[model samples]
Target: MASPQPLNGATPKPKPITPSEISAEFSHHDPTIARINNGSFGCCPSTIIAAQQNHQLYFLEQPDNFYFNILKPSILKTRQIIKTLINADHVEEISIVDNATTAAAIVLQHTTWSFFSTLFQPGDAAIMLHYAYGAVKKSVQAYITRAGGHVIEVHLPFPLKSNSEIIVEFRKALQMGKANGRKIRLAVIDHITSMPSVIIPVKELVQMCRDEGVGRIFIDAAHAIGNVNIDVKDIGADFYTSNLHKWFFCPPSAAFLYCKMSDELSDLHHPVVSHEYGNGLAMESAWIGTRDYSPQLVVPEAMEFVSRFEGGIEGIMRRNHKKVVEMADMLAEAWGTELGTPPDMCSSMAMVGMPACLGIKSDADALKLRTHLRVCFGVEVPIYYRAPVEGEIDPITGYARISHQVYNTVEDYYRFREAVNKLVKDGVNCTLLPLCEGYAQLLQMLLKSSLPVLCISYCSAVDV
Candidate 1:
């Protein structure tokens, strides 16, 4: 029931949402922890969780009735619901997979299967951005490499100067492939990147592929579903995949893959083969190992949950975008760090720089700091480290990927801010966070009890 609103147009100010209003919608979220990492694994609302429980209980009660009757129709009903969210031409073109990774494998395996009119010829190349998800890159290597092809990476700059820079870099990659006497058979583009989260100009890039004579296009949109307004048909890619669990408030692992109807997709099949081997993508993907189908079964309720907001899904998206930008600014100013990406290039997530005093020199250091935050401060957020890219000589630095959801409030960021300030005052370095489990537990207990004096005494007396 989405209206015909412009996906990327400016929005009027969204109505302010209070914490109690958020609690009414998502009271299921744990109130103790400061959860600002919704981009990683989404927190499901209480109503959707209850609905999922009902589906699971129904399946456990009568397997045959649930599988034979509720399963197939429920899956198709989800396809119908999501078809409008992305503006797909037909529900038949959509297939619900476990997640974005599985969807990538399904398309990659089909494209590389040694059959009639294979997409990857010998010495062919597939174009991908340097910011592509690590697992998806491996899938390309597994399938495309086995087919005697190579991967061409578009080295887009970090802290992007402009969208034009991305478009220019993409053209260079396509030309580089052609210059090497290789046919660029496939182009994998991310609708929004994972670690250093930034929105890509997928529509322009898709058209650029057509102009560059690329064979096929796959949009890896793991973080695009609920955060951004999508018009998949307008983007015009051969295939697109987005994870519902990331931003759409589905349970654990539900995602949709859209394949444009064409002769090339005639041999497309799910990675897992079952009774419906020769069936289309939808039927084949329906019965993959008989797993819990709650995630996919609850799609209608999830859609309904978002529709209750003031502007429906679009309104929620605008609200989240506004909140994230504001928080990022506050953090950057407090910590004396810059924002990694601009507001226009972000959706519900933005990369805020970590204070340099944390002394994070690698991903390992970043992980240790994040662990300390979790154990001591009861804050859960993602911190990513990006060393200098290809041509840049910048030093390796850490960035906190802050995400905004309906349940989040200003206090969440304030908690994180005070926690870091305490660590800095306590002289705790990222590389030197307390590794002793007993020590961490003691500090955590003291912090939870609101006895910072005791925690400080413990910190000062404890020797690493």
Candidate 2:
């Protein structure tokens, strides 16, 4: 075990990093930044990225050959690996998609009938945690409303005290829906929440949905796949989706959607109804009009690469959980703020409350402060605004989402900590205070310049 090669000018601190975990494996990552934001859009290993590139080139070299002969097998193989990885009942239950958002759209679209009958009769309800991913939440609202249904949000306390607390809140939502005569037609649960990262008690939530007689259950496990051990069948959700690009160390925008293999899903389909409309979800998703399918193609290499570590993917996850919890707690202690989540409730990512002295009162402030951290200090952690609770009107605005991957070390967290400390000491006003100073001036100049899109894209697209 040794330290990874020093990134930028930072010296490698001795740790238990193996040769396979060296920086060369992650050469695509920016060497200048302390990229602790793996949960946002996962960073892929160079080897796996190379594998995808080769697959892309192979597709380009012979378009008809790749599409007609080569594509389905690669997709099927990736789905097969995912089926085994998540303990799905059958390979056909898994369909590879672009990301969790697309997977969500597919599920939500089919949840309602287009013409004669609907999954929701007039006032039926679709239940989801208030913490559901924003895009997924929007999709639920849009699709369910079309079916003459409505959305019911199950609001639970943040910095949740125990799994029991979540169970109680969800149960209340079910009962309230029932009492109000709004049949709980659908339930969406997060296997792991995005903003304030926590390992949701998904099994319990799924069982609760079943017992409550919810029509169909969808586990939005977008951040789950490589982040935790999943037994999809055991969870018993009708629909489940997880993103390989987010945590499985795969390239951008690859994920798996799992539907329970039964007569109930005979009409399930990929949202984009192309030439394969009448076919099953697998066939329909397989031929989505000839874009780069390289990410899904190289998933085998991504999963295989996990073997280079000591105990395989599960072992890597265990080590990552330990490291992230330790680092998050360190940030909380050093910043004089508390952790939003307890240790057991968290997985490889956790939310650490940022110091209040930074004047981050709104999400806008959080966004600018986030940019300030990137430009002035070269730190790349996601700064988030936590949701409110019953009593507190103004909850904490900013929490640093720290993620731990095999490529990351304690030194990265150290870099983030030092940057925040410097900001606090220097009185960098988050609002109008210091957007004119130092590197921020350069960031603003780039934004205002006719340099086209990079600067504005950097600010908005990179945030979440």
What candidate 2 gets wrong by more than 4 Å, as runs, is 1-17, 114-119, 387-396, 433-441, 444-464
RMSD of 1: 5.8
Q: Per-residue lDDT tens digits of candidate 1, residues 70-149?
A: 89999999999889889998998899999999999987887687422563568788889989999998999888887787
Model 1, total clashes? 0
Top candidate on lDDT is 1
For residues 1-464, what per-residue lDDT tens digits would candidate 2 score against the true structure?
97567669676433444665667898778777898989989878888988998999888899899988889998999989988988987898988899999988888777777312753578888899898889999999988887788789998777776888988998999898787666888898999998767778989888888888898899999999888999887888999999999888889879899999988677888877788878789889988886888988888898668877767788889988999999988989898887777889888998898877676767777777787778755789888775445696445657888999988978899999988787677665566534335556666566445554333322332221
| Clashes, model 2 | 0
TM per candidate comes to 0.89, 0.88
Q: Tell me the lDDT of candidate 2.
A: 0.82
Clashes of each: 0, 0
Stretches off by above 4 angstroms in model 1 are 1-21, 114-119, 388-396, 434-458, 461-464
